[model samples]
Target: MDADVWTERVARDYDTSSTHMYAPEVLGPAVDFLERRAGQGPALEFAVGTGRVALPLSERGIRVAGIEKSEPMARELCGKPGGEDVPVTVGDMTTARVTGAFSLVYLVYNAITCLLTQDEQVACFGNAAQHLAPGGRFVIEVFVPDLQRLPPGETARPFHIGEQHVGFDTYDLVNQHLVSHHYTVEAGRGTTFLSPHRYVWPSELDLMAKLAGLDLIERWADWNEAPFTSASRSHISVWRKPPSRTGTL
Candidate 1:
């Protein structure tokens, strides 16, 4: 996470600018999916911006903590209605140590892409695994890279072209690097937000989990449990630590 990029200005406007994601229709399903796997969590959210998902889980009586690198974003989250109850540590998700063995640890909304390197992402998986007890699960929600959709000579794809926001992604296929350009117009003033990410294939993520001693348990196209297919745009993946036993294998 880049604190320099996520300035106070960005954090201040985050909730208002992305109000659509706060809608019950959008957050309800995500919360439900996580709550089910929480199984008496103590869930930990990586990059828990503005407590978008954490507070809701807390509302449902699930203990939720968070690791956020951007202090402004974490401050914005901590000030929410029930935010104070959800303890947040302002630190890197890849290595931030928070107490408690979580039943579920999750990174949502492609936040893993922010790591911008294979090693950081792999370390993030390790950290999540470190925080989990035996039989615990880790979840990640991320988009499938749109390389297939790009025209032969094109390096960018426009995903949103609405009045409030115009957004697109530019790809560096050789390195699997991606930069999302978000142009927003509000009150006659326009602002541009450029977020860089390293896109990883689903298979790569599964291998990362395996390297961390986790097993792939389930995968879906969405929080609704839609089947993940070649045509899917995004995916929700689940991996579980092996059940505890008295003796080692």
Candidate 2:
């Protein structure tokens, strides 16, 4: 499918369904990690969808701007309360001018996978580096691919939910990418969403960061700073722009 068409379909249902889609509840912890390391400086959110973390983070008094590629998603964000205050540019993250240096630049909700290629993903890190002040950090939230641990016939795994609508995500792993089929069924309505993502190893992401002149500073299984272990399902990785350009890692 064309990227434009795929984006359009997501734009329409984003607020209604996608916003509430992710489970294991990581937003609070992700934001909290940023707050602790971000200092009192400004922030830049890459996708800024529906101002999910942006609005709440801004309400906490963090100055924030965003680079949002989808106009419809930006428009949806603008309609929310306090949404008018966030400064967002509707353009591609790879080359978009985010304006002003920020102490923190974050792309949450596994948005980095939206780039579809390693080159594009690496470019995004470069773009983030260009907009960061010295000592600023870029934080990324993503799920580690678990297919290698499962059997060949296994595709679906029961994911997060309390007790209500049980959910499962089925994946087709080919090459280094995963074609995800997410199905969550409620009492009456059932939703199935397709998400095709390029899965990256933690070491590969670190290399990408290094290429952009950033160094891996921290890695956590959760935002609460849980130790990164093989059993961890997701990761919040933080990279720092060196305070001084001594070029020493």
Candidate 3:
């Protein structure tokens, strides 16, 4: 599917289908982590779709701000309960000016992969770094791709499972990207959706952090501080900016 079309359709159903599905469960721990690390002064959320995390964080008096590229998504956010009060700029996260040097800047829910290019991903790191005060941190949540799920030399992984059972499984692995097809059958009807995603190794993100002049501070398999080991499937990685060399001058 075309990117624009996918984005447009996603903007409409994002809140109802996905945002509401996972926000509270994810955002609760995420906010707590940021507050503990950065003292909850000010924060910038990249791709603050439908105020899923932003609204809850703002309610904690964190002085949160957000950047969003999709106008429809922004509009949908503005219409939510308590959402009108949150300050969000409608622009690409990599190019938008966040105004203040934030104590914590974050991108969650694997939204960074939406950029779909190494250059864009690198620019995202630079932009996040630029928004940080000295010693500030950037936090990201993403899943590490599992090569074991893919068949050799094939970009497609066909898979099917549901809340009840597994019907089939297939994965498409292509040049650092993964797409999954999960098919569901119910009442003599079958449905399928292609969920496209880019999966980067954790080490690659650390390198991105280094190139952007930030250093990895901590990594967790989950928000609850589960040890990041080979057994883990997802990660919450934190990187901190080094203090300026001229501070003593």
Judging by TM-score against the true structure, name the best candidate: 1
Clashes of each: 0, 0, 13
lDDT of 1 at 245: 90
lDDT per residue for candidate 1 within 1-249, as digits (tens), equals 567878888898887667667878879999999999997757999999899999999999999999999999999998889988999998999999998798899999899999988999999999999999888999999999998999999999987787788889999989889899988888998888888899998999999999999999999999999999999999999999887895211
Task: List the candidates' TM-scores in order.
Answer: 0.96, 0.86, 0.82
Q: How close is candidate 2 to the true structure, as a TM-score?
A: 0.86
Q: Please write out the lDDT profile of model 2 over residues 1-249, one tens digit for every residue.
A: 124534655665665554354432746765677777677999999978778788878888899888887787788788889998898898888889976888999988778877778898899899999998888899998888776667768876655453333445566566566665555454666666676677777888999999999999899997888999988888989999987575422
Top-lDDT structure, candidate number: 1
Superposed Cα RMSD, model 2: 3.4
Q: What is the C-alpha lDDT of each candidate?
A: 0.91, 0.78, 0.74
lDDT of 1 at 207: 96
Off by over 4 Å in 3: 1-8, 19-25, 151-174, 180-195, 244-249
